[model samples]
Each structure stands twice: as structure tokens, then as C-alpha cells.
Target chain A: MGLKIIVLAKQVPDTRNVGKDAMKADGTVNRAALAAIFNPEDLNALEQALRLKDRYPGSEITILTMGPGRAADIIREGLYRGADKGYLLTDRAFAGSDTLATSYAIACAIRKIKHFDLIVAGRQAIDGDTAQVGPQVAEKLNLPQITYAETVKSAEGGKITVVRRLERGVETVEAPLPCVITVNASAPDCRPRNAKRVMKFKHAKTVTESQAQSEDYIDLTNDRPYLNIEEWSVNDIETDMKWLGLGGSPTKVKKIENVVFQAKESKRITNNEEELEAMIVELIENHTIG
Target chain B: MGNLFVICEIEEGKIADVSLELLTKGRSLANDLSCKLEAVVLGHQLKGIEKQVFPFGVDVLHLADSKDLEIYTTLPFTAVIVDLFKQEKPEICLLGATTLGRDLGPRISSALQSGLTADCTSLEIGDHEDKKAGKTYKNLLYQIRPAFGGNIVATIINPDCRPQMATVREGVMKMEVYNENHKGKVKTIDVDKLLKPEDLVVKVIERHMEKSKVNIKNSSIIVAGGYGMGSREGFNQLFQLAEVLSAEVGASRAAVDAGYADHERQIGQTGVTVRPKLYIACGISGQIQHTAGMEESAMVIAINNDSNAPINKIADYVINGEVNDIVAKLIKLYKKNSK
Candidate 1:
């Protein structure tokens, strides 16, 4: 009675803590300046999947992420926490993918990893903030979706209940198995990496990573089959060439402009009683504030 | 019909303010394109919903009043709107970037293979020429939004897609009435014919949607804080200052993410946009994300220990001081001066 769960995750630039150098003078993102980490809400999604695995004994969690070869880091990170396995969906064809094309690629990968009772993903990535991929993936796969989920109330009798944290309030909803659920940040933070699991999975690497390693490392992976993280490309999944990349994307970026604020002629006020009182008096007289 | 369509959202049996704002925007966009402005509402007890939107200059109102459509499940609503868009072939489609609209908009776009831009800050009708393809698209909806963590503003377009789609957050567009006497035609949808049994798979077990207690959007004066506030305990001074000035408390997304303030009070690209008469920004460095929400304030006062804080660039008065000390001083000075 073990349920199979696939958690869709991403390695996104840490946009939340963007620095002055995070953007280039050319108005493009300076990706090298931003640290790439497992998307925050995706960790929330992982925590939900882990909780479900705890409730359903023997439930297996698979971390599926789409990015460059280095995205394997998040997969290993997932394994170090509690997931049983991971897959990296990487290819040149995925470059310049908007949410729709990204979801199409992920949905195709999910189909290849079929036989799952549930699919989980973060409500939105911090970088894009579109919050579109989860529902789009559900539509691409023709599955029911519950977005903004704060908690998984239960999963029993072939049905799952989730509490969604909406803008105004919360809602409790139930959908049958084999559906998509996108977790919100309001959900509990993911549990810390397990020491034992980390020791066991520290050497996990994708095929590309394995090729770059020493022969001794390759031998270790052969001895430990679980160390191999699956890597899939466009050829690995059945996909239409029309829906694979920038050409497949319906939306196009016509222009991008760096944010430059027009400086106002501001009056500088010292932090003293006299200046502060004088400013307050002027505001009161002008009716700007009482 | 190459009309401009707005998908209306309902709250407490009334048309939400965001929907009306979009209707106002749709009216103008439709006029620019010389096309009709249409609105779609799906919910129960929506008998007089047209009355709510007609003043916004909607030329046609499509209503699908059904018990199943009331609470807003994904599948059925998507079925109805996707079905409607296919038949009508709208030139542009807009929806409020709320929980309901974000949930439904992507599904419809994916089903129809159309482009959708989320959380747009501005929408304009313009022309685009693809230099490589030697093609020009006229009157395309420019979906402008702050991207890459609000570091840059991008203009998105759907050159080849039918029914260019975009979602704007509440308050991003102003809600204005086109005419008090404006009237529109109503067309009821046949939900039963569109929805299959599988569409009813998800069920709402319970729902508790309370009106937001904080009214920051309409507040004329806002005392906003940021991550520099240090902690929740540090925010008490801001609350006291807001009370003295008869202002509402707002926060930067950084402050909200730091757990120093509530999410409802967040002011940024991702949060509520406010244009208060006076904005007293304390301890905020003024990232574009935060500034995009409140930069439209009539007057601004920036108080931070860092004199070089980015917020000072936009402020009418810049005070170099600690947030707690400066806020306390402002509260005391304002109280004494008023008396």
C-alpha cells in the first residue's frame, strides 16, 4: 500500500536576497552573482511529501528537477533529507523556456516516471513568481490540481485532503489520488538533512557528473547503484519539437529595461529635536499630516 | 469575435474590486483596438452581476450561474471559460491576479495553447516588429512587469497567439466608471453541456474566507517598515507611530519574509500596492519591488540610519537616524504640534 510521490523542484537564483551586483549593466540578470539554491517553497513541498511518506509506511519520494547539470545538487540535497531517488531534466532545448514550455518539459518527464499517486511542486519559484507552472503541469497531464496548499490534512481511502492558504483565508479540499498539489510557504519548513542519509548519499552524482569524476569514483558508483542520479534529455522523453523551447513558447520578451529611479530633490534633515520638530510643524501647517 | 474579455471574480456575492478595475482597463484597451469589451462571470446567485460591471463600460456580459460554479473549482470553470474563448476568439483576455484567477488563468491558457503573463504591473496597446521574421504585429497588448526579482522591467508580447492573456493584481489598475447609464447585453452559459463528471473530481470540504482586517490599500498615510526593523518586537515602534499619525502600518516583502510583519501588510511587487498621501518609510532600502508598490505616494519621508539608502532618492524628506529613535521622535513631535 505504499504510495509513489514525485516532487517537482528547481534550483533557482536566490532572488530574495539579491545584491547590487545581481543585475548587469546590460539589464540582464548576473546569474553568477546570485547563489543558486533549492527553491524555498519547493522545500516546503518536500516537507509535505516527507510527511506523507512518514504516514504511509514505505512510501517513496522522488525529486525531479529541470536545470543544467549542476541541478543534480538539489537532487542530492533531496536525498540527503529523505527522498529515495532523484532525476535531472537537462538539455539545451530547455533554454529560454517560459512557464508554459517549462511545464511541458516537466510534464513529459513526469509521464516517463509514471505510476505515481501524487505530484507535488512549490506554488511558484522565487525568480519567476508566475505561479503558473503547477496548474499548467496539471493541465498538461490532465490531472486535478490543488494550488496554494498549506498542509496535507490526510491521504486515505484513495483520496487526499489539503488545506489551501488563500489570500484572504484558508480552504480545505479533497481530491482523488494521482493529482497535483502545489505547497505554499505557509506550510512548515522542511526538516533538516539527516546525518545518516547524508553520509549515504553524499557521493550521489548524475551520469554527466560521473563522467567528470575519477575512475575510483566511478567504481564506487558501480558498487553502489543508488549513487546514480538519473539524467534525462529531450530524447529521453516523448515530446513534440514544437513545444520544447523558446520557439515553442507562446510569450516573447519584447524588451527589458533596468530599474532606474528618477531622483527627487529631497531635503536632508539631521536627526535632532529642532530639525525634527520643525519638519513636523511644516507638515501640520501644509495639511500633509495632522 | 475579436473582443477584449475580462474574467470577473466574485466575493461575498458581489463583483470584486479587481474585476471592476480590469473592466475599466478593458474598456480603454477595447477602445484602442476598436473592439467590444466583454466580461465573463461564473458563480451562483449572480442575477444582477451585470449591474455591477456595466458602468465599467463592458459591452457584453457572459454569465454562468450554477451551484457547481459558485465556489470556483478548477476543472469546471476552466471548461466553461476555455469553451467560451474558443468560440469567441477574443483579441485580449484579462483577469485579476488573485488566488482564483491565477489558478484558472494558466489552465485555460495551457488548454488553448495561448500565452499568459502573470502579475503584470501595466498593460498597454502597442505595435511590435519582429526584425528577424520581417513581421509586424499592431496593437499588441504590452504585458509590462518587474522581473528578475524586480531588478528589471520586461515587456512581454504574444505576437502569434490568439486571445493574448494577462493577469493584473488588485489595485494595479484604477477602477473608473465609463458611464452611469451604460448598459450591456447578457448571455447565460450552458454549464451542464460543457462540464463532464470528471470535472467535479475535486471537492471543497470546508472554506473560511474572512475579509482582511487590515485596510492598508485605502489608507492615506502609511508607516512602513523593512527587514532593517530587526524583529517583530522592533515593529512595535512603527505601530505606535502609525497610531499617532492616524496611518496604517505596511511592510516590505523582506520584512514580511523575515517574520517581522504580516503578509497582508506587505507592500511590494508581490504585495498590495498603495499610493498613500504620505508614506513614511522607516528602515526600508527601497528595492524596486518595494518602491513599485508605494512610489506613487504624493509625498515621501524616508528615515533610516543609512543616509545612502535607495529610498532616500525618491523621498521628499530624508532623515538619517535609527528607526526606533526617529519614529518615537516623530510620534512625540506630531502629537505636541497638533495640540
Candidate 2:
């Protein structure tokens, strides 16, 4: 039994640098203005997984992501950076899923890929910053999970050790095999793409993209296999249909509005000794100041 | 009766300060919803915990006593909470947004298939309208948190989920007054069968606490230098000002990332949220993330070379000058005033 390490990666819109056009008419995200990149923290997660493969020579590292078909760009980037395999879970049925529904789909895919030693995810996705899906998938799989892991101490003999970043300090702990660990930004920074590997897998395409390319019927490059991730539809996984999408999701977005913070007009009271005392008393009475 | 569940976390027998803060905050929410405030304590033979929780306003305390539960573990701790939530349907669940809370709250909430809001800065009771029933429900718990890189405050509510959950950062709420005569009931839970050696997959071999030369979080007077603190030598000047005031040193995210100071002393969204009585910003550009964390400080005095810096807009008093000159002047001023 060899070690099979899989990382859950997401290509999110560049939220840190959101511009005016980042919002649509409905106040939903206008993803067009946002350039998609491998989520910053997920890069850290992928680096850790790559390091694991580095330490244990024969271990296989696969990158798994769920997004639109355009997300294949991330898979190619993963391949260019030494992942042995890439799996993309994309379907129109998976749209409008929140963190819970997203986790259900990812967990189903993770379970389908049996005999995996460890799963790595970024502490939280930048888009929602919910920090729910990673741990949620771990719970669904019924595995012991370590979150905010700063470093992986060891992974051997059906056991894993890591240092979790705490508020005041860090706690070092070892968990049994088949555990889920969410890597924090404090994890060692990711390595740059391997140019040789990039040249080898740059032409890799998804099954749908490849089929589309075949219909166009023009071979652009003869470098590497057009590696398209096996896209699975709703019927691909064994899950309760009732618990899969909008039906299974118990929560819904009531509404999203631009929250503007504005300071209230202040009736400036003179800074006299008596006024200060009176203001303090009034503040205490109103429960605004302690 | 619906119980307001307060997940009280303790470190070394003494309940964590944030837990008390949560208890105080929970008291109002529980009262607003007409529910009983319950404290859920998990540790190894902890004694006198119920007595301490009284002033914080807990009515009942659920104690889970076990040696294995002494150290924090995701498996057993989460399992115990899940079972408790199932057995007791709490209307609102509160946890301190500490390291342990952030690590455990999401897992438990997800396992129960409920909504869990993290790092909430403000919370209150409001009216939520039911879409299906087309009626307004009064006294719905409102969980307000900073989002969009802390650009604005978004209000969140768990409409369908029975227990409205939120993990608030420490220092965001004030602790209640402590009274000696206060009292509450403590009940010990025996779940040895549910928790076993296999459940304890994670083991802490050795725990080391870092020695703090200057922990800004607890500091009363903090001299915080930001990106405008030109270089390492400039930060040292702020440190000197702190030393003269007998205060602690702090830095903005930019300064910390620029390697001017250690990350431990960072004060912002990605850093520690501080509410010191007096906060002095030296040459710091007031980014939203930094302002979001420190806006609650009692008195803010911003010293920036740029008179128009955003930090000045929110500052109670703004001193316009170079950080070096301002820090040097402040150090000299402190020495003169103290002497």
C-alpha cells in the first residue's frame, strides 16, 4: 500500500484586489473582472503535499478541484508543478452550492478515490472566507482532522504529526493515518513551477475540452498527453440525492448587500472636567462604554 | 425549553478569560430569546468551575470529566458536543473565537448541518421575516462580522438552524462584573464509552509556551509603528517610546511583513485584535484591516507624516510629522512627563 496524497484546490477570483466591476447588476460577484488564480493558501497546501511526495519518494500527489471547465488551467499548473494526476469535478448541477453542498460533492469525490493516505486543504477560501468546507468534508468522511496546521512533522506507518498554530503559540500533535489537515499561511511557502514539467504537460486538456478540440480536429502540440481530468456528473457518486444539492442544503443566502460603514454625526461636548464626568456617566447608562 | 449553549473553554483548570467574556455576551442573547444560559465544560476533574461562571450569568453547567479529554482533541471533543447538541436542542450556541474555538466550532457546526459564523465583532437581536410563512419573527439573533477584507460589516443570521452559532474574537466583548454571592449548578457527564483510545488519534507530546518580551494584546499603552516606520531602526525608536511609557510595542501588517518586527506583535485582521486604553500609531497607514481591529480602542492618537492618511480620519487626535521626529519627541516627552 503506497501513500496517495490528494489536495483540494480551488481557483478563486482575485478578491483582494476587487475592482468596481467585480459586482454584477444583482449585487452578485462579477467574476469577469477577477482573474482566477490558485487560491493563495491552497498554493501553500499544494506545496506541503509536494514536499510530502519529496520526502517519501514513491508517494503519488494528485490535485483535485471543483469549478467551471476553465479550472483545467489550474490542473495543468498542478501538473507543471509535479502532481502525478489531476481530477476536476465540474457540472452545471453543482452550481449555487454553498460551503455545505460544496463539501458534500468534494467528499463524495474524495471517497470515490479510495485508498488515500491524507487530504490537504487551505485553512479557508478567500472568496467566502467561511473556513467551513475543509473541516466539513473531514467530518463527512468521519476522520480525525487537524486545522491551522503550520507544518507537517512526519507522515509514516499509518500516522501523521503536525504543528497547529494557536492564538498565543503553536501545539505539536500526532494523529493516526487517513486524517485531514488544513494548512495555514504559516506553512512553508510554495515552490515555483518546474519549467521542465511545465513544458511537458502544458498541452494537457480536460475530457470536454479535448473533445471540443477534437471536433475542431487540430493538434496544436505533440509534447505530452492531453491530460483532461475525468469530469463526473451528478450520477457519478454514491450519495443521497436528497442531500446533494439545493435539496440537501439547509441554508440559503437570504440576501447580500454592500455594507457601508459611516460615522454618525457627533454632538461634540466641551472637554471640561464636569462634562467629562457627565459623559462617562451617560455612556455607562447607555451601555455604550464600559 | 431551548437552552443557550455556551462552550466554555478552560486552560489549566481556570476558565479562559474569553469564555467568561462569551458567558457575559451569551447572558443577554439568552435573555432576549427567553432561554436558559448553559455552560458546557470539558476537562479532567475540574473543580470550582461552576462558582466562577456565576457572575458571567450561566444557569446550568455541563461538566465532562475525563483524563483523555484534558488535552484538546478534535474527535472526542467534537463528538461530545455533537451528542450534546442532539440531546439538547439549544436555540443559540456561542464559542470564543480563540484558536481552539476556530478549530472546533466549524467541525461541530458542519457535523450538525448548521450554520456557524466566525470572528463576529458585533451581535444583537433583530426581527427576521419568514419567507414561507410571510410573517416577521422578532428577537432573531443578529451576528455581524467584518467581511470583504474588513471593508464593511455584514450581518448574518441562521434562520432555519435551531441554534444560531457564532465564534467571536477575544477582547471584542467586555467581561461582566464578578460577584462573590453568584452561583450556578454543575452537572458532570460520563461519556467514557463514547470516547476511547482510538478517538484520541492526535497526541501532544510536549507543549512549550513562548516567552513574551512584549505581548501587545495585554498592553495598556501600545506604541504601534506601521509601514511608514521606514526601517528597523525606526521601529526601534517606537520600542524606545514604549519602554519609556512602560508600554508594549505593536506593528501593522505591512510593518510585520516588511520584517520590521515579529508577527506576534502585529495588530490587525490577520493579527491580534487589541482594545487598549491608549493606542499610538506611528507612521501607519490606516488600512481597513488594521482599523477594524483597533477602532474599538478607548483613545486613538495617530502620528503620521501624511496628514491626510486614513488613520487620521478615525483618530481622536492626529499629529502630523515624520515618525522619527514624532517618536523621538514622544520618547523625550514621556521621559519629561514621567520624571
Per-candidate TM-score, chain A: 0.98, 0.85
Candidate 2 residue B233 Cα shift, in angstroms, is 5.0
- How far is B100's C-alpha from truth in model 2 (Å)? 1.0
Question: Scored by CA lDDT, what does every candidate get?
Answer: 0.93, 0.77
Residue pairs in clash, model 2: A205-A228, A206-A228
lDDT digits (tens) for residues A1-290 of candidate 1: 67899999999999988887887878788999999999999999999999999999989999999999999999999999999999999999999898899999999999999889999999999998999999999999999999999999998789999999999999999999889999999899999999999999999999889889888889999999999999999999999989978998999999999988899999999899999999999999999998
Instruction: State the weakest 10-residue window (summed lDDT) of model 2 chain B.
Output: B330-339
* Number of the top DockQ candidate: 1
Q: Candidates' DockQ values?
A: 0.90, 0.28
Lowest summed lDDT window (length 10), candidate 1 chain B? B228-237
lDDT of 2 at B62: 91
Q: Mark the regions of model 1 whose C-alpha exceeds 4 Å error after superposition.
A: none
| Residue B74 of model 1, lDDT score | 96
